[model samples]
Target: MKKIFVLDTNVLLHDPQAIFAFEDNEVIIPAVVLEEIDSKKRLADELGRNARQISRLLDGLRDLGHLHEGIELEGGGVLKVELNHRSFLRVQEMFGEMSNDNRILAVALNYHLEEIEKEAAKQVVLVSKDVLVRVKADVFGLKAQDYLSDRTVEPSDLYSGYINIHVHPSIIDEFYTYRFLSIKSVPGASKLYPNEFVILKDEMGTSKSALLKVSSDGARLEPLFLSNEAVWGITARNAQQRMALELLLNDDIPLVTLSGKAGTGKTLLALAAGLSKVEDEHKYKKLLIARPVVPMGKDIGYLPGEKEEKLRPWMQPIYDNLEFLFDTKKSGDIDKILMGLGSIQVEALTYIRGRSIPGQFIIIDEAQNLSKHEVKTIVSRVGEGSKIILMGDPQQIDHPYLDTVSNGLTYIVERFKNESLSGHMMLEKGERSKLAQLAADLL
Candidate 1:
């Protein structure tokens, strides 16, 4: 049966094109939701961009028909802006004050009651990204759901970027002897992506094994180009780390992604490889690091300091990893090292847009906070002669509108899996400390 979906302000802000995503169903936008979106149209961030896009979309729809009344959407759905349904007094009696959330709830409640009076068969559902709004809808005995049209992959079914294949014992021996084996030589080697890593073990339970990666041509599997090599005095502590280092140190692959939980060494490994390429080998002109400025909860308001001082708290984790790499004992030693090199630049992801970056090794940390459009903008700005690394923990997302499946990090990993110029690795083991590993596993 066709359904009526009442969208919250956050649903539109998360994806401006959500109106056309419901197919043949009817989409309702309460007037209070538009008020909230209008308030956010002036900020200079991803949210503001989305808000502006939604405004343009609604304005375009005005030419076809009045939004107060229903209009037919291009995708066979009906879109309407519900102006007369803002009965805040009725909402205040059930839930308290007429906040924006409660006002949105009122629209759903009004529609549901009217539907019952008309004996309609269509279901009325409230769609939102806010957990509190969904819970309050339950209090009113209304059906509520999360918007799932843009989700690309589930967290539990996320790609690990590598797999283990059992082969004949001679295949492993031949891989070591010849240093490369045809992909057809493996029994279960069908449909492997380019630059994907593999662990080749013997099917007879022999102790022979090899770590190989699919060639760019997808016709052969070659031994890892780099093995146990130290990058900035940091060696791989496990097999997954070794695979990540291989992908990081390769110049031919321009894009690399790493996903792991806290204490998994994702940031450390990326930073180490970036430093090695920029400082030691002079392969790139500079080492650039940036991350989104997402807050855990409510923001702390404007910061008070110079540019670098204001960014200190947000970039401290990068600085900590750099300090460990340089082995700085003094408090100000990291500053001295960066000054002497004159090639390291750390900035927030806010200023990265509208600029072309070339001849640099770029690392985007905490990338899970970015949206799909935001990540596309960042990657499109990559000029020639540059390598970009996106690393993040999908489980620790701070963006209120994004979850593990819809965030930028997971989106890039899934979209670029088949590309020949990109490689991905999911580091499983935590090499930071024993306590940190235990906390990550149990807590």
Candidate 2:
């Protein structure tokens, strides 16, 4: 049956193209949603950019017909700006507020009543990215759903970058003796992707194993190219970390993604690899590090200082890792070290837009807070001879509109799993400290 989807303002902000996502379904935009979007059109962030894009889209639709009267969409569905259904008495009495959310609810409720009166087969559903909005919709006895069109994969089904295969004991021995194994030798290897790490375990149920990575051609599994030598005094303490290091240090692979729980050394490992590539190997001219400025709790707004000073708080995690790599002992020693090196740059993600970064080792930390469009924009800016690493914990997203399945980090992992130039690893063990690991696992 054809459905009627009432869009929340956040849905549009999260994805300006969300209106076209509901296939052949009638899409309704509450007048209040347009008002909210208009209010955000003048801001300087990603929200403002999305608001403007959606506004332009709506304007383009105006050429076809009046929006309030309903316009035919390319997908054979009607798109309408619901102006007459703004009656708020129903929600106002129940919620005791004249807010925009309640107004949107009122529009949906009026639609529901109209559908019922006409005995229509169309189902009225409210789609939103806000949890509270969905809960309030349930309170009104309306069907509410999350905006899930942008999710690349379900959270449970996400790719883990590596898999264990129980092979015969001789297969492990062959891999050790020859240091290479054909994918045909492993069962169910037809689905293996380029650069995917494989752990060949003993089929006899022993602890004997060999770690190998699929070659870029997806034909053979080869030993890790990284030697036993540590990068910048940091060594992988776990197998997952070692897999991440192999991807990070391999210049042939230009893009790498690392994800893990808090204190799993995602940032630290990336920094170490970047520093080695930039300073020791001279493979890159500079090491550029950036992260989104999303705050964890209540934001301490309007921080004072220049651009670098304002970015200090957001980039402190990067600085701490850099300090550890440099073994800085005193306060402000990192500044001195960075100044002397002249090859490392730490900046906010906001300033990276529209700039072409070349011959640099770029690390985008906390990438889970970014949207798909944002990640695409950043990655597309990479110039010749540049390598970019995106690291974050998808489970710990700070973006209100993004979840583990929809965040940019996980999106890239799944989308580029088959690409030869891209590699990804999900670090499972927490190596920061015993307390941190315990808290991550238990608390």
lDDT of 1: 0.90
In model 1, how large is the Cα lDDT of residue 171? 87
Give lDDT per model, in order: 0.90, 0.90
Q: Provide backbone clash counts, one per model.
A: 0, 0
TM-score versus the correct structure, for each prediction:
0.95, 0.96
What is the per-residue lDDT of model 2 for residues 263-325, given as tens digits with 9 covering 90 to 100?
999999999999888888999999999888772222335788776787788888888888898
Task: Tell me how many residue pairs clash in candidate 1.
Answer: 0
Can you tell me which runs of candidate 1 are displaced by over 4 Å? 86-91, 117-120, 295-301
- The residue-level lDDT of candidate 1 at 305 comes to 80
Candidate number achieving the greatest TM-score relative to the actual structure? 2
* Tens-digit lDDT string for candidate 1 (1-443): 88999999999999999999999999999998899899989876777888999999999999999999999998889999999684667679877787889989999988887787775568899999999999998987899999999988776878888889998898898988999989887888887889998898889998889999999878999988996978899999999999999999999999999999999999999999999999989999999999877832123247888878878899999999999999999998999999898999998887787899999999999988888998998999899999999999988988889998999999999999989999999999999999999999999
